[model samples]
Target: MRRLTLLVLLATAAPAHALDLTATVLANKTAYIPPQCYTRTEDAQGAVHNPCQTCHTLPRSPNFVSDPDLQQDYAIPGPALENPWTNLFVDRRAAVAATDAEEIRDWVRADNYLGADGRPVLAARLDRLPPEWDANGDGAWAGYRPDASFAFDDAGFDHGPDGRMTGWRAFAYVPLPGTFWPTNGSADDVLIRLPEAYRQTSDGSENLAVYKANLAITEALINRADVVIEPMDEGRLGVDLDRDGSLGTATRVVFAFAPLEGVTMHWAGRAGTLGPKVAPLAAGLYPLGTEFLHSVRYLDPRPEGVTMAPRMKELRYMKKTSWQSYAELEEGALAEKKEDADFPDRPKQFFGSAEAGIPNGMGWRLQGFIEDAAGDLRPQSFEETVFCMGCHGSIGTTDDSTFAFPRKISGPGAFRDGWYHWTQKGLAGTPDLVRADGQGDYAHYLRTNHAGDEFRSNTEVISAWLAQGDLTPEKAVALQADIAPLITPSPERAIALDAAYRMIVREQSFVKGRDATIAPQDETVWRRVEQDAPTGIAEPADPWFYRLKR
Candidate 1:
């Protein structure tokens, strides 16, 4: 159920602590204006609609944010990391009022918001939908999104054949009980807030209401901010300063979405095409067929099921491709090539080249791995309980109950297993790792909690239970406090819904990529942005580079 509550919270190992997370990492540059749009295109008729909010709040599907011949790759705040105490809300602004700090700055960089006396400001709209949140009523609009009708069904994931839509993906993570990211893959204390199109009821998904949005670390601290934590291992969790102004030391931030390896949701189809001969993209860029519906904006496709129709040509995107503005992720790194399907790193593990079809959503931000290295964790880098294996361990299937893959790694590596460790590019297998049934204890073995059923590598039963050592720090603190609240993430999942929330915390029918995700590469780049992403009362800088350990 819900991914076995996300593998029992991915077998708890997060000991490190020191989280103020500066109002959830300055609510990650919040400001996302996508008030609505779901079109079936039969002239438009399925449900949900906003047609475009007078001055732009949400009505450009595919997540629209265009007009960037290139403003730092599409800027709105995406590549981020120029630093100003984490650039404090980037260009900040967009607060007419709709709380939880404007849904964490509209999930950051959608445009930056928070003006009205709160401080760091910039956004300007105000027509209807804000008469003061009907309270307990039904009129709804306290500001989360999805009012106009609400239709979410991309119809059997279209494809006209093998071109698009096989759809169905979910993976949510804003679970804040003590929220904090960055074990060491390095998106560094990541923060992103999307929520605004969901009112749907005609059988779509998120009609609304998830609940929980705190943000008050003394508002973010300029004075009363004291913190300390760093334990690492049990899986992972860490921190020691960076609450904004301890100034450099363990400095860390990480996140890496893996639908399976690298990224690349390709399709370039129509519009004077550059490489649409069918596939093989990368060169000069250009290939988003029909400008990709509403125009190439990076991430805006929510059909989940049923609506499918528009499959040939429509081209009308003077803007909105990959729909720019999470401040464009800080400033670069999303040419969208599905990141190239990554998993084989043991030394290059036997080479690449195997792409083909179906993909276009689910970049779970590579689930988890971030290390600031001041002490223990950070061996090569991979902390934070592997962040739920980015999608229950990148599917490709494993945890083998019987169906195997070690005859020497075939097919998707025989449907994957041993949670991936391999090692033989130039012949590296001996103790080089390739485990699957060594015994068990990989901090508590996973694979959606072994649901794919037949798993084996318990590292020789945790090395014969640490060599019959009768381990007990109160039995490892009561077996990690009974699996830490069962799988943390409740506060109503830190409230903030726009449409899809993803609950599969655990499911392992050999997920070795059966339902894949982790996509990103589509192709489109220009980038130039300099400043302007803050919005929520900016003004706070000190981090010479992460601190709080001494």
Candidate 2:
């Protein structure tokens, strides 16, 4: 009965073009894999290969909540042994060479996400119960509706027409240094919605002040640093906020090793400002009902400059459906490792229907909608979603199987401690992120990775940052002040890359590969690899945060 329901849902929800593609993908699921799973093990020397450190690394400070054993060995499971990403092997230079750059530019610039009525196209479509997306045989969409208006209040909450909060709050953060950087391929944004309990005061009343305070506290706990917040009345809350033995005016949430010791306030706070009471807030984990909505889009390259586009390439959703205690998370990781050891070569299988989502072994379940051949959103096949689990499920770099939220820009310098959207303010004039040891983040990435992206194929970045075949100290200093020059692609390269990806979409060959490439990537990628083999590195590399510490 469950299988029949799923078949009905897929038949009703997926478009004809997507149905064919999904069928093809499902028929030979094991034959397909993402190119990123194949790490570059060998360097130019062909010796001292060190690819394991990219995803598998020693857990670092502020991220010690994950499995520490992941750094000790390679734990790749099934479907990762072969390289089915044929897109990487394709020579797309001809397609790029024949493209009308101007026409492609105009098409990209035209917004596909919004209608002439100035409302979201996906939102309107979902509201109408379109057969192509109405799952469960229900007349209404049961899944997440497009509620983020991109219009946020001062506290970063999105409000609907009834003037009630839509519950989706958009926040800005430093983009993770590699492919996630806009110059690589896509422009993206992430919005978070906490469970209703977190949005209320101690007495269960919906007060915006209490909500903002709760968010600030969560930010402080996640980042493990003092968070600056707008001034609020602490006396009325009846919480002895500063540990100063009295209810006082509080300007920040103090992250302290000993809260009773009365730690010093952040430098951004005014003289005599006190810390908020944080004894009640849990550390490192979001509530079980939390949801994150992320949208990946194309780059809007205009004659003047490049910015984020309104047309989305993909929409991803993650929800925490269950709560795994700290002991449970550790036990789960060890159990999975034992299973991998027993059958290292066997591909691990995930259990779930495509209409719902696949569980990531942790508490979260992920689902994604991507563009079809016609550039409209459709559900991603099971195999495509498996690619997401590899990173979110067991990567050592993640804190609680997540990124972005922990790396959110904070302190007084950031605009509202980075709780806004890209549309509110793009990534220009944003200073380089400084690590705990005060090293520049972007500069360190370029120095270590030697390229803007993981593939090291971004010629635009290589030419700019590695003009002399190396990133010199002088160039590194310049990047520390402003990162725009290091991360933004030239208008010509942006248009060409966009054109290259559209070719893959038209071909409906996402099962084979989905990377946007102007040419074949033979130099950096492998066709196949032996499972559980040594990655050829003597010592595991540190996590991205720890590497920047020096």
Candidate 3:
């Protein structure tokens, strides 16, 4: 009997199977390699090679490197004098002739041009290619080389049957600037938003590219996360859910880590920012160990009726499912006893989902983890292992129900006038927090911040196309005037307008032969094509802007 007791103690004393990792250590070892294309040349005649990393890198150049449509045909010179080459060779004078450059661009774009040794040249563009493509010449451009896999979802995600958000679609929820939780434990705390039961509007006005740019910029400012779940202090950071000038009874906030998606916008003609840029990893995306943390809060007994204030309406509480990478949970997790003394920090609870097979847990890596605001790893209860639905799974946010859209410009130094106008006057329990918009100079925030450059550039180019269906020097000037007043009073509103206008221009840019060489008679069509591409080649929407605001 004594011998049997000794064996039980030995088994119990042994630490949970191999999960003894600190938050920092775990973050360092499990580096996420973003998907990109690459080129490798062995011989003078070898074919150019492109893996995922290689494909995503070419577009990052200041000049156009590859065409999304794979257009190799030379473009006819027009009065505007656009570069017709599909490759990065933008200086037409360097080519033997314009047509020569165009032909070379085509060969490189198609990934079919043979080098001296006869290997395939790497394809340069991914935004234009479908999720899957045929690199092996099987006559099928199946979804991205192996399976149209996305960097976030390549590890396999689960959204359950009812939730269809995954793959590239799930990227819409990636966090934005100003939302990164600062570690100072001071006033720069990131706000926690509750999930709205019903959506109030259908205005899909948030420009995704602009949103993405802000996120990239913010990633440069603050990269660490305080992952601890803090109890919401009604007097400190709570919002009046019903705009009734009162805080909710209880609010629990959570912050977790995720991989940063594509950071900068890499359009053919757009200029990059003068501000600092995040260096790309070998995979051409954010490097491994680079982390993006998501913040969510839960409010009990959601309020009803919206009165210009954010509202949460529901009697019952809602929580998100767990998300996991393609990597499976470590063995022996399931059999581990939940009642074990150390169960809170156990790997099973950290990786398991409260709601099994739900969409939130699968693609977004919304697994439950225990950590403080400083990212100090801790143990969490199985009950607390719910996934985050406040942003990714919410039903009312403008950017596909994610806070990425609204917070795009809501971050520090974003608003010149401050956010006072958006809320009611003298809300009870509100603190005297200093913010960019506090001075009532929204324009101050709009003109000074780096995002202003992106917004103005998008507005100047996209607004012209929306107003005239084509771009002209005169049309461009006129549209800029119309958008100027709206920019300062409300930067977020202006950004939403910019997003909406760009959507229209993007729809018209993808018509067939939009990039092909053409005769003078086709000049109008070509000009339309040029104007059409106020954004990049990829259609953010299927029927361009359909259900955009929903």
What stretches of model 2 exceed 4 Å from their correct place? 1-34, 44-54, 60-79, 116-119, 127-140, 161-163, 202-204, 236-243, 256-281, 532-538, 547-550
Runs in model 1 deviating more than 4 A are: 1-130, 133-144, 147-169, 172-265, 268-550
Every candidate's lDDT:
0.18, 0.66, 0.22
Which predicted model would earn the best TM-score? 2
Candidate 3: minimum summed lDDT over ten consecutive residues — where?
A: 180-189
TM-score of each: 0.17, 0.84, 0.20
Best to worst by TM-score, what's the order?
A: 2, 3, 1
Instruction: Give the per-residue lDDT digits (tens) of candidate 1, residues 428-524.
Output: 1111112233321211222112211011111222233233423333433333223222221122222211111111111111111111111110111
Q: Give the TM-score of candidate 2.
A: 0.84
For residues 265-330, could you state the per-residue lDDT of candidate 3 as single tens digits? 221001121212322211112221122222221111112211121111101112222222212221
- Candidate 1 residue-wise lDDT at 299: 15
Residue 348 shift from truth in candidate 2, angstroms: 2.0
> What is candidate 1's local distance difference test score?
0.18
Which 10 consecutive positions of candidate 2 have the poorest summed lDDT?
A: 265-274
